[model samples]
Target: MSHTEKEATLYRMSTAEHQCPYGLKTKHLLKSNGYTVDDQLLTSREETDRFKEKQNVQTTPQVYINDKRIGGYEEVRKHLGKPLPDPDEKSYQPVIALFAMTALLAIAASWLAFGSFLSIQTVEWFISFSMVVLALLKLQDVEAFSTMFLNYDLLAKKWVPYGKIYPFAEGLAGLLMAAEFASVISIPVAFFIGSIGAVSVFKAVYIDKRELKCACVGGSGNVPLGFISLTENIMMVAMAVWMFISMF
Candidate 1:
């Protein structure tokens, strides 16, 4: 009887050169031991951002056994002596409900905070800083999207990954957030934010083809991009109009 070769595990090392020496070694050794290898080498900041979003992993050198993490280098090395079925890996959960709940609450808090900060210089700083942040994120998203055109199967053909898109959408959301901070813009801002929230709720339910990750209201990670984007834009425009009305 012929024996079947064990399936090679999947290991993702950090972009950092040092954090995953063991993972690299494991890849090499696994090949020697007759197993296949898949490597997710992240180079762009946006790629790193997507990995973070997908895994909710804060650090790099994340190693996975067939999609499960055997921890990092040390952990993998330690388990090297174990049998092929290590049975000691963790599964990655894409949608974390607790995180999603926290995000919703944070968005609510942001509206209140921005509303209170409008009279202060923080509004200007938040607007400018938030734009810069979102712009950088958008640039990264564009680059990632372009790469996906050539490798559609590897990456979903979405315009941008959810992690990257969230920040882009947030740019518009921030504008509205900023408007809410102004005393003259309060009612408009409230209405705008409220509108965004409503649309977000609707989108979360209605969008069928949506695969984008939610980056709304503190990374609540639930709202869909379609609804949230529209919601935020509406709020911002409404706030601007309300600011005009409040002036009189």
Candidate 2:
């Protein structure tokens, strides 16, 4: 066949009641890739079902190149040699959202408590609130969190139970600190865990040059093990030390 004669066919749903987005996307993709498309629209539910039955396909937005079936959007991309992005790709979005929300909450709380939005108390509350949020994310699925935590946490790697208990300990310390109560236990807990976490993150990302997902939020999170993880631990350690010094 001549290059000028190259043609593709697309079957998509475009009824009076509904229009398929995938169908539009597939059509756009084909046109952008330089294929002349013979667009076929199924105008009714009955017509769509019949087309699916006749084609022996289960989904809409089916494509054909030179009369050879090329499947849907995903398959078409593969056929065009473009790899689909991984759905589980690592990202800092989850951690970023968590910290942002925690900071906002801390400001609100500090204002209510001391009539000041920006103060040493606000920083302490921010750290405490962040710990609570992170703990809750881990507690959502303890088993999953523990598995991911073990990947790089020095204490969790050595003693498996530490992985399971870490979330609860973090939550307890955060609650106590936020309320300005039980500093005796909360300060020590935060210091010990935060110190261990800082060392572990530094070793994993800087010393060993390992690439891994962070369990600071949870196992399902795609947060990378690097600066964000180190920052979280350092914040906790600083809060613990400041609170401890104030106690004396």
Candidate 1, 139-212: lDDT as tens digits: 55554433422221121233335434434444554554454454444444445444544454445435544444
Best by lDDT: 2
Task: Give the distance in Å from residue 59's predicted Cα in candidate 1 to where it truly belongs.
Answer: 19
TM-score of each: 0.29, 0.73
Instruction: Locate the minimum summed-lDDT window of 10 residues in model 1.
Output: 148-157
Q: List the residue pairs that clash in candidate 2.
A: none
lDDT of 1 at 116: 47
The true-versus-predicted C-alpha distance at residue 33 of model 2, in Å, is 17
For candidate 2, lDDT tens digit of each residue in 108-143? Answer: 988998898999888888899999999999999999
List ranges where model 1 is wrong by over 4 Å: 1-131, 143-211, 214-235
Q: RMSD of each candidate?
A: 14.7, 5.3
